[model samples]
Target: MSRMILRALLCLPVLVAALAAAPSPARADALHVGLVIPQSGQFRLLGDHVREAFQVWDADNPGAFGDIVEGDDGCTPESGVDAAAAMIEAGVDIVVGFLCTESLAAALPILSNEKIPVMTLTVRADIIGEEAARLGWSFFRLAPRAGSEAEIAADAIYRFWADKPFALIEDGAISGRELVEAVRTRLEERSLKPNFVDNYRPGQATQPSLVRRLKAAGVSRVFVGGDRSDLAVIAAEAEHQGVALSFMGGDALHAPEGELPLPDGTMAVLASGVVPGPEAEAARQAFAAHDMIAEGLRIPAYAAAEIIGAAANRSDYGQTNLVDLLTGTPFSTALGPVTFDATGERQEPGFVLAILEDGKFRRLSVDDASRLTGESQ
Candidate 1:
């Protein structure tokens, strides 16, 4: 009897070893994440930056958690839906990316139905506050809302140039209209009305007539709601026409200092959720070790990776409860302490006012414009 029992026990150990070597049930540890971006098209530059940022994060923290499934959305709704479906088939835990608002709107239904969370890098405010709520909790944004920055810009203008006449030039896009409206509302709240408000088509060949109108209006301070390219062109034209207006620009102006050319004494402000400083520099160094540059949408992408890493690290390793960790837990990133509100917006301040001096954007105090724009401080 003892010999028979010994043989049975030996057989049990072999059976267990065989089972362990074979396939097991899939769990959260095997889950992957999908990164959907415009890897090919007009927005490719932004997408490459985001990709490089994630690559750097993954390299710095091996086996941190989740595999990245790449999907090219091409900045279109149709492509975004296709990408989301592919990610679902691949069993990704979350979907991140979509630098364009239209693409985000296109992918929303699929991700919401699948209960997959998305962290958009775009700053379109209406999409998150209105669309996401109507759709579901599966949507979140790390980028600052559009209206918030506009409001901040208006406040800066009001506080700085209370005595000077101001003008607004918008590109007539959705973002442009929103910015113009928000700034208008903010100015109204302070009983300040702009001297002129006009919408111009972006990328138009000749803005000479527009410049002439602006000069005729006697507009001194100009608020531009457009991308860097359009803003630069307008600035050049304004300079040529000898319009001595102090320009204020959106976060799009926060490109590498010399990337855009502006006239001497052209002061501008940049509104963004994250400001590149010491913490950003440290993160950049870490990213460079893996041959990556942190810029554009890359900062938010890196922030998302950091947030995920923090959540995974805090949980018992290999555990399956990700939603709980992400929703309830707070994480500290190179940007700052990050905590998502119920709506998935990062509960933090937005906008870092910058000044154009000596052909570079220097971080300035909120009141710096008033002192600089004034005849005598």
Candidate 2:
């Protein structure tokens, strides 16, 4: 009995050694990403596109994401807070998507406290810039800032209408007024100025008097602060009165559902436009497969997913270290090479200028806007 006891004790150490040598059950390699998007309300369309883009990418690449938690922000600041809290409860390592500016602003501090990195797929340029500056490095934006949009818009106006006498008009909305001011400031920097500047009441049926005012001012071109619909009345009155005028607008005119039927030669500045490249091929194919239109938030959402997936694959994606892993790496995404500038914004072209031709928006070359619009090159 004593000999048997000794042999058993000796074999117990050998068993322990064997157990230690064998690999433990493989840890879950999948990463969890939270999607905070509007599932209802006016912004639901944007959230749906963002969700589809992320799902398509995940499905195409098997085992990339372990679990996806969706929190509907409903495009409201209060809902944003709730959504962020829900994501934290779900044990999400990172968050992607917050289409509304207010929603994103409300969710920032909550997500930041949990150290969960957020990749914004929407364009609230100024909000992102301000938050990033104030809070250090928790936010990563894939879209252009408002100021960036304004700067590009200003450049677009100068490129196309520098030699022509143009008028600047706004609908009195703060955004519209700011955009006009941006363009006007850029023009003045070049020793040029608008022939006329004024604010017109929006939603008016006929602006015969405003048209006559512009005609008398001898302005051949007009830069509107709002969308095509904002200037539709003025444009009709101008055409009826035999006033030959061209129109220009900001990003609102690049509406995915199509802009109001502005006349030919009308142009709008977009923060970004799809340019074919190797990186964009997969998403283009994925979108085409489902007959899903890839516009606005779709491309940006895909890019955001690619960024998080890339970061996860490159490093250990455990919860407390995700942000540290994403800081300095240059992520190659469908939107092309993406690297956050010092302000945590993507470094790329400021904007794209598209002209309405035959009732469609066409990509306009930057060489000169005048030649494209029947003005002297």
User: Against the true structure, what is every candidate's RMSD?
Assistant: 9.0, 8.9
Per-residue CA lDDT of model 2 for 198-310, tens digit only, reads 88888777787789889999999898997667676677789899999988888777654323467877777765534334567777888888788677577778888888777
Question: TM-scores of all models?
Answer: 0.76, 0.82
Q: For model 2, what is the C-alpha lDDT against the true structure?
A: 0.77
State in Å the error of residue 361, model 1.
Answer: 2.9
Task: Give one clash count per candidate, in the order shown.
Answer: 0, 1
lDDT for 235 (candidate 1) = 76
User: Where does the lowest 10-residue lDDT sum fall in candidate 1?
Assistant: 266-275
**Candidate 1's residue-wise lDDT over 1-377, tens digit each?**
69999899989989999999998554334347788877776888887877787788887877765688889877777887888888889888778887777777788778878878888877456555576766565777777666668767887788776677778889998777877788888888889999999988897645788888899998778888877667777877877888876788777676653444765555444534335555567677887776666656677778888887776565353564565567645776656566776667766644567776677665675466556667532
Q: Cα lDDT of all candidates, in order?
A: 0.73, 0.77
